[model samples]
Target: MSLFWKESDERGHPSLGTVMRGVVLLAFLLGGWLPSSWANQVWEFVDGEGVTHIGNVPPSAATRGVIWLSRVPPASVVKGKDRGPSALQFPGYDDVKQHLEAAAVAQSLDPAFVIAVAAAESAFNVKAVSRKGALGLMQVMPATAERYGVAARPSSDGEHAAMEPKVNAQIGTRYLADLLRMFDGDKELALAAYNAGEGAVIKYGRRIPPYPETQQYVEKVMRFYRGLLR
Candidate 1:
């Protein structure tokens, strides 16, 4: 699940500074650090410290902190989109399809599934970065990538080398495979771990955690996966 967990206080609460830093960093990334092309009218939501979301439709009621890039409002945006949720597109998916396939094959995983996860995670944005510091097409954290044998070298852009498309796919697919094995080949639990951290899944008795972000993530990925399969 988590590439590396943030330190918590004696009472098992994340430090206030850590939480604040994440919020500020998210604002910076969304507001400016990312490419202007990513500024599409998107609806987003943040549930706790999990990876942020950008989808065509509004998030579920269980979610909090809905973020809108436009004054149009989430409901209005969704209603205006004639193509519906399926209208969500992966902008650069074609560019990294080969890498995704290679990594999936190397890990004995379904390439469609791997691609779906990447699509859901980053929309195939090679330069994607999350508030929790997850990066690249697969959004693998640097520490977690290192744990999977991907060395953490800084790129010229200040992003970690693990963010490199090929390397990120490799580490991410490997991690997914491990999570699949850990959960006895259950893709749902594996995905829940991918979104919410493996420890969170175990803590919740190997079921998908109740976090709305994680629940929606699993559903979205599987939906993408099924679409890919067809």
Candidate 2:
């Protein structure tokens, strides 16, 4: 009844892992039915022994519990990337407030929007980490970081560049500016695209995505932005 043929544990036959790898290779060669994004087409599932597999094919391990693909966009490729901050530093809201304001000014946006986003995203927490792997005050995703030229600090003690307040504010503000421009200065649509994905916005006819989380996120951020105005 298994989606994948089982391997005998006692006899040590080729494992379900091995079988799935072969199938994945074949699928790679065929390339027609598989999701063709460079985002790894990753499917994660835990095996009976609690071993996790992230690859193109799902094995019998999927029966244990949940299995799903992480459709995060592939990191944009660039040749000869510039070096990130060689020496990283951590600063709190008070110390970094001026930088945030400067970044917003450079982007020709209201400082309140940046402050509100940072507040809504991480409550100004310097070390915040999202379940979806977003890091720092702006909760920048790796793909989004890559798009906005944010990088991990070279000397960080396990902290990403996005977790560094100054860097995150700068890059995140630039990203918001780009989104606003893309949506033709529509704050609602831009915020929606920021919460969901630009592709999702386009898919939904240039409106907010249908997901409840994103809808609420837009509203919450707007509320925060408004409160900052007063």
Candidate 3:
């Protein structure tokens, strides 16, 4: 993920003198920015080459070097816990249970299987977005959205139809149900199609593709589902 910070003036063009003044002001501001609330919670580490870095936790690069600094207080703690599900706690567990039960009742599929699919797809992250621009909890892609009557609008305020958790889940579950039907209730084939695509799976003669990522993704999701059962 990329994060951006604005540190410059908004003017498109500034005189050289103004730019110099701005740089000086920025330097002063940065100098005074130390000993902040987060200082105590922040830590610093040195690499093998003696280059130092400051962060909330030891930098991953420190593995190549001896410990220059152990766990130190952060300058400040972000006062909140992670709002997402863990390996143990699935978000919206009750709602997922209800939805799975309803799906199983209506489609004659297994509720545990549906839950497993949800676990694999988004880990219940309602705002999950895949690299291919799939959206919402179940990661419904644009073409699939169109096939399932999900409206694709420009991503903006009031264009949140696609982001609604229930809408996304409903459409995703329905699409999965269709895939299940297409594969004649073969869960493996259906899952493979979900991860890769139905066309790819069909072209490969109903087998998991030779692509390593797709194959591993299918297997991992199945493993997670199986774990849920146990």
Candidate 4:
């Protein structure tokens, strides 16, 4: 049986608190366990019947839109002691924000999602390099950069062209957009492919790989993306 409640044809309605608890219970059943992070926020999405579902975890496929419920309050409410901080911000973000935005627009992807990946991958550091040789702001690998038509330029300092903010952002966003398409717009699966390679995702039945690093990478990027949407 479906764990969620369908709206009644009559006027009867459950309390909001009851509805929320039901969603949390559903989350537990679906995930087999609830992470502590799930307690900090919840999301809402509407079903085909126009019944809204609220839960800590979004469905793998959201035909409608997912709405984040934990955004910071309006400016008028800032004087309150319980005020929450604004969306996620990274150091040096302003320097490369334009590049990320442009790349996202070109790829028909969410600017916030692109920025979140950059934040989680390199904290907006254009010179950042991973031990595995992922390069630049988005930590894109050399081969992936080439596939997107971004070539490494010969330099005396040995800095690849991918280290340039604009080139890196463009290549990274394109690669991510391709992944999203490949995975049928499933953000988690696309992100898994980003972290662990598309081969790994396909090998695992198009699910996020079992690798802890890839799992954590997806969670971190999603957290940043949600915060940015807030």
Candidate 5:
């Protein structure tokens, strides 16, 4: 399962500065960054030992110790609610980019594609738990993990195993690759299968299922995937 790995000191990895820049750029795209038209308010606040969370929708009411980072134009609320952990939870791309790249490459997937999926699924929250019992960075269900041979161990239970960032990335990307193959390399169909189910995709004659969430998920991830590659 440990494939597509590079040395920790691998040359040519993007620098921290580059990662930060990329994070901001990706955040802008995801959060609907407007140019010369308006500014979105991403509130920043510190908690327990100075961990700061910058969020378009602040965790709570803004008060002292809450800060906002503005870039040109007047501050305004950004449209759309974000998934758990939000975009700002990722302080920089460096935090998760390498894992995304490694897992994607391991599964013969485009790194940006994997990243886009992760962005949509959990927003890089390694501990994210969905209401439907999906868990971890990739929001992997324990059953899915079992099917993929990365099922959680009995000692740690399936939940904790899926919570591991690297494990989740690997298993999740592998599952995505499986979906792609099942759909004959059609990314849209593959994504639909990933979000909805292989059964749903097939029931719909290999077209993206008509479910609103699945359709929106496919489009959003594709947008990020294409934008990042460009």
Candidate 6:
């Protein structure tokens, strides 16, 4: 039998709890007979359907699997130490770019606009979590997650979900597209609405909200978008 575990589904967007449980179960199964050194090398993947598989290799959904495996350090290590705090890196740059381009084109939005939003939302920090519990690189809130058909209770740390960079970018870009549509494609108004709710922008007659943070946030993202284009 192949040492690797395979889930029924091809997509690997499994629930966090499911993945954690799978990891534990795999440890138990292999721990009994395997050498300590061998046990340390076990790996697992949870499918989109929340089924967990244990193995030496990941399923096909893990196209760039070996890279992730190699990069994974001890759980005790902190991430992003080499890169400065503000400069976060995307795990799958090509995947993120592909999805962002598609979403922007479909929504008639400037691709830089979507990228800028992602930058501001989480500084491209896939593991970013807002104090209010927003999760992933997009910092998607729970209600927003439900609306987007994402998991209602995504992992609080966002590490696992964020690692699936394409998914996070797609959700974030789509939400921005919706805001743009709602604001009649006025990028500034849409950005303001994104930072400070559509209702708030509407109430303010499409002006940036009075909230200082929201106002600054809108301006900052737009400035960054402009810079990216230049």
- lDDT of each candidate versus the true structure: 0.64, 0.56, 0.53, 0.64, 0.58, 0.52
RMSD in Å for model 3: 15.0
Give the best candidate by TM-score. 1
Models sorted by lDDT, best on top: 4, 1, 5, 2, 3, 6
Assess every candidate by TM-score: 0.65, 0.58, 0.58, 0.63, 0.62, 0.54
List the pairs of residues colliding in candidate 4: none
Instruction: Name the runs in model 4 displaced over 4 angstroms.
Output: 1-87
Q: Write the per-residue lDDT of candidate 3 for residues 1-230, one digit (tens) a residue.
A: 21111111111111111112211222322211333554434433333443334354323432443343322232111344222112224445565566555755566677667766665565555655543567665667767777878776766564446567767767677878888899988888887787777887899898876765466456545655555555
Model 1 pairs whose backbones collide: 1-197, 1-198
The C-alpha stretches of model 2 lying farther than 4 A from their native spots are 1-95, 153-156
* Residue 41 displacement in candidate 3 (angstroms): 27
- Tens digits of per-residue lDDT, candidate 5, 150-230, equal 766665344557678888898889989989999889999988887777888999888988775577567656655654554
Q: Output the number of the lDDT-best candidate.
A: 4
Q: What is the clash count for each candidate, in the order shown?
A: 2, 0, 13, 0, 0, 1
Q: Write the per-residue lDDT of candidate 1 for residues 80-177, one digit (tens) a residue.
A: 43221331344566789899999999999999889888876766767766555777778787778889877766667677888789999998999999
> For model 6, how does the per-residue alpha-carbon lDDT over 24-105 read when each residue is reduced to its tens digit?
3333332224345554443444434444444543234443322121111112223632211111132333435676677677
2 or 5, greater by lDDT? 5
Q: Over the full model, what C-alpha lDDT does candidate 5 score relative to the true structure?
A: 0.58
- Candidate 3 at residue 157, lDDT? 62
* Predicted candidate 2 versus true structure: per-residue lDDT over 126-195, tens digit per residue: 5666545766666677777887776666764877767777777888788889999999999988877777
